[model samples]
Target: MISFHNEGGIMYRFIFLLFLSFQTNAADFVHPYPSFSEGEKLYTFPDFLNAHYYISYDSENKSASIKAEISFKTEEEGYPLFDLKENPTRVELDGKEIETPLVDSPKKETKFRVMNQLTSIGVHTLRVEVPLKFLLRYTDKGVDSAFWLADLDDRSFLENYIPSSFENDSVEMIFDVSFKISADQQIFANGEIERTGDRDFRITFPKEYTSSSVYYHTTPLGSFNERRFEIKSKVSGKVIPVIVYSKTISNFNSYEESIRQTMDELEADYGPYLHSSFIVYDADLSRWGLGGMEYCGATVTNLWAVQHELFHSFFGRGVMAANGNSGWIDEALASWRDGGYFSNQNMRERRALVLDFPYVKKTNRLAYSYGKNFISFLDGNTKMPIEMKLFMKSLYQKKSWTPITTEDLIVELDLFSGNSYQQLFDEYVYGNKSTLDASELWIEPNSSEHSIHRKISGEDLYKIL
Candidate 1:
């Protein structure tokens, strides 16, 4: 996996692009500075990233021919570092072709590096043709394709199919996508979509999205008997459109009913639903034991994990984990809700969530297990009844679309609870320094056999940011 290495003692003004344009010259999403050495500055990420993908999918051939025009800028000279698991058919730096040999061992991570004199201190563009991969597959009736990503999909995300950056930086992405399938396969995405042709779509995803935020899927007819309906959002008065699909119509009905109740319950708890619409890929997930993965407002889920996955739209995908260490916050929060918010359990296991590196893509596994009880314990320790729930709602309102850290959660909790829980985390969550070990840290391995259509996007797609 190609990731950044941050060195301490770096004091630099990184003009990060927020929801505003680069012309604003604003510094909204600044990279944290423990401090940077003169030598270490070269390894830091770019100031901004805007990627435009032109994709043409051929269903018969089961292939996707893709080209990405990635535009970015930097204040200082640095190398072009992009995490793409698939090798590019061709690479270009400012319209000039460059060789991207396999930088790592074939057994290791797939990586590409841009080497040219032009990679110095200004706006630059990398136009590359990404290689074809499993962006599509044949289901029994038709096909299923998705650019799905999750919290544990370490170093693999938007870059899994196209060229993209890390999750910390909310990159602006545009997709000019088209499909040449049996006229039956349909595209499902969470972005603003404009149909330009019979199967061509121009998708404009939110600029607030990071590497893991996009959820795009293409499923064929007969593979799923889909039912589209509407449900009113409690938080927002908008009548939210919902699409639920499954192999059978009975499953669709059951899922729709469950989704309605679940959405109402979650909205009653959290402030509101965060996405434009909600989509469910209700399937038998007995094969994938990990249950479900949540996208922004969508999920490929079984019936059991409906509430748990949807809760993520308000927390995990909504508030967003700034780094791997903070990733536990949502999982624990969701699992705590799953366990009925019981605040009386004894958290027997002690684990370490504080890792050496902040940007590790994998979260601590205990987040789904012991971490659940820990959050409940925190809630119990709070001053009011279900104070944690109220704090989470406030957090969802404030930090929605923002990336945050474990320390941020601590500070927020301290302010809301009027008590410091740092010592609680230091002892139970962080564990003893003498016995601290990162054995629990791991990435959720990608499984092709079964998945919650993990929260799986498009196009003014030709325009550059």
Candidate 2:
């Protein structure tokens, strides 16, 4: 996390980074992503597309083989594009030589596979045409990628492709995945892995996954165990099971205690956590980034970034704001929760940030100013709590499980708070107003300076303002 302060004592900002680290042991796979089930069909969008993969690993040669199951919905018949790295040796499609197109200036691997002439639609099988070593090289970033073989030291298949879109109206598909690894190495995936042999395991997706990318990490650092939490929601009409992937097994540990507290607070405040599992990784800071990215039912976060990222389960992944502008709502709300709702420490740090950093001139006030101001306004306004609930509900009503824009949120705020958000926007967001008038609330100042500095408790601040 980075803190900025300004000499003018006008504005303060704390900019946080996505921390990365390497896992020391196998952590229980926690669903950092949102997931849901429709009828007997389970569905989630981890990224943008629906992907199913079968992977096998060979310990003797440090290699792996993969078969992908893919399905895309279109009004007309068309084939999906399979752009791959150049190292694959044997290429086949249902056991035949398929001509691969070579494009100039390939991003990673120079080759691409296109089934431009598919005779059928729905489910299609994509078998590897080349050797496993080539696919491994591509997934491992030429074997020199950072965090390669950090924990498991075994060969694995990882999907790195981005999905076309993340809308909620898309169709869902299931993944039937199986993997073979060395007897000594452990494997993890989206769902539970059922072992069939000493060297092979299979993972079945109980729901339709969203992302086109699948990730596999091979390390030798620590061990993992599976745990389940049943979440009964008052808002949604489902009992979601939350999976926890924790490196620590003991409940008395501080890490576990922190997680429990955070979970309790978040569940009490936000809606139920809608995932089968969540992963708590005891990883080194240099490997995976600071916080975890939300996957349908899985999230990857190091210990340091857990609380902040967990809060994101509600703000970022659950009620996703629109792209490019939603970063403010997602990040700032998470930061506020992590910092304990602008407690004394938070206020001190925020005051310092204003007095020490360059926040007044920042162009992206949506992220820095609007986020902080909304939090502060919520602290001050008596109607804020109910208004916030209504605001979130309005977002769901308007967007219907899709990402929404800031303008959408502003309208929702107007409806709930009975005040034009444009006025607040002009005063705080565009005009850069920080401190509210203490006189309006009948608060007496002990001393007057260029800026007012006082210790305000979270509860007192809420009541006073």
Candidate 3:
């Protein structure tokens, strides 16, 4: 569980880290992410939620609708905050109808739905209905639609179409997706799909899924062509299936070997791939090169960015970041892999990745460049025989599904390397307290990270999809 700490008007979620004489009990925590309740008032969320969404899409009219029934058990009197960017068609709390007033938070710069009435400490049920319009764009022969959400903004995860909770709570999300599409089509999701009826699917995700874990993309069969293949994981030798899809072009010939090599190396260095299968929506990513978004087991990527995005399946998507402040760890590791994982004896003169305020849910853009340099420094300079990479492999195996903080990473490093890395993190990663001579520092290029929002434009979305 998290307690709020207000300093200089910014509230921080203080996670109970294991530094004391006694270790914190395992069953007392939801998640370690710092998430603000975007309602009229701040509400403590101790409710574990499971949501089932019945979604129907009509591609001819470019419209859709979603009805979500969420069940939860509350420890105390609290508000069950769920976000649906589109004003919900209807909202029900415990089978009683409630007003769907849109709460606008200029501080968070988003609008979402929240329960106005607080519930008594017990199990509760909530229902939300939302309409999705104009989300489909027709191709010449087929149509293209994606429930695409990168961790781009405060309100951009699974909450866009279906009713979704915050990052701090892992929920089981079930999607009953039905289509009124005329063209023959198939749904691409990170979840396992079972065909229930004609043009209907029951997509069920793992019980331990958070907000940013699911990947859902839909298009006409010929609008995008796919090549399905299998690869043996390095650690477990588990035959993992991979599907690469593109806009009616067979451009995955050269990428097959790269994908195999990358997956093998990743599993060898880290552990088994957590995602049951991998799906790559290789949209060419040409409008801007070296940019893709990482989902749980799937990615939307190109040749140049394939390795970096796939590396995320282990670190970013697997060993998850609990909050935006902790978001630098994966980007740094992925970028370090991208930039050849160069270990440097000398530390670099770089800015901090964790900022001072309003950064609880925002990934620092400099995480790509400066963050990688710091990781390289850690990899090179360790008191123990093993470097930071080995520590990460162990961390991945231990904390695959658990969301963690930057402080947690530092503490783990301290324990693994048997040397204190806190001051280094304080001086370099969290605060710019170290002043070094420019000539003595290692200099890496100010390279952009692999994110579509930072690398591409609004016009590039359609092209990338």
lDDT of each: 0.67, 0.38, 0.71
Reference-based TM-score, model 2: 0.52
lDDT of 2 by residue, 1-465 (tens): 222222323222111112111111111111122332334322222221344444555444566555554443221234334444434444454455455443221212112234334423223334443333422322221121111110111011121221122222222333332333322444444456666665445665433222221323333223445455554545554565544454444342555555666767666566565445554443333232223443334445545666665665556545554333233555555555554565221222221111111111111223333355465565456533334543554553444334444555667677776676665445443343245321211222223210011222223211211
The per-prediction CA RMSD against the true structure, in angstroms, equals: 7.7, 18.1, 7.2
Candidate 3, superposed: residue stretches over 4 Å from native: 1-29, 32-42, 46-48, 100-112, 138-143, 382-386, 432-458
Q: Compose the digit string of candidate 1's lDDT tens values, residues 288-399.
A: 4546677778876678788788888888889988667788888889878877887753556666666555446656666776677788877775343347888998888878
Candidate 3 lDDT tens digits, 311-366 = 98899889887766687789888888888879887775857777553324546666
TM-score: the better of candidates 1 and 3: 3
TM, every model: 0.81, 0.52, 0.84
Clashes of 3: 0
| TM match of model 1 to true structure | 0.81
Model 2 bad stretches (over 4 Å): 1-50, 76-184, 196-198, 206-208, 212-252, 286-298, 320-328, 342-386, 393-465
Candidate 1: regions farther than 4 A off: 1-41, 59-62, 99-118, 138-143, 181-184, 249-251, 345-348, 382-386, 432-438, 443-465
The top-ranked prediction according to TM-score is 3
TM-score of 3: 0.84
Worst lDDT run of 10 residues, candidate 2, spans 145-154
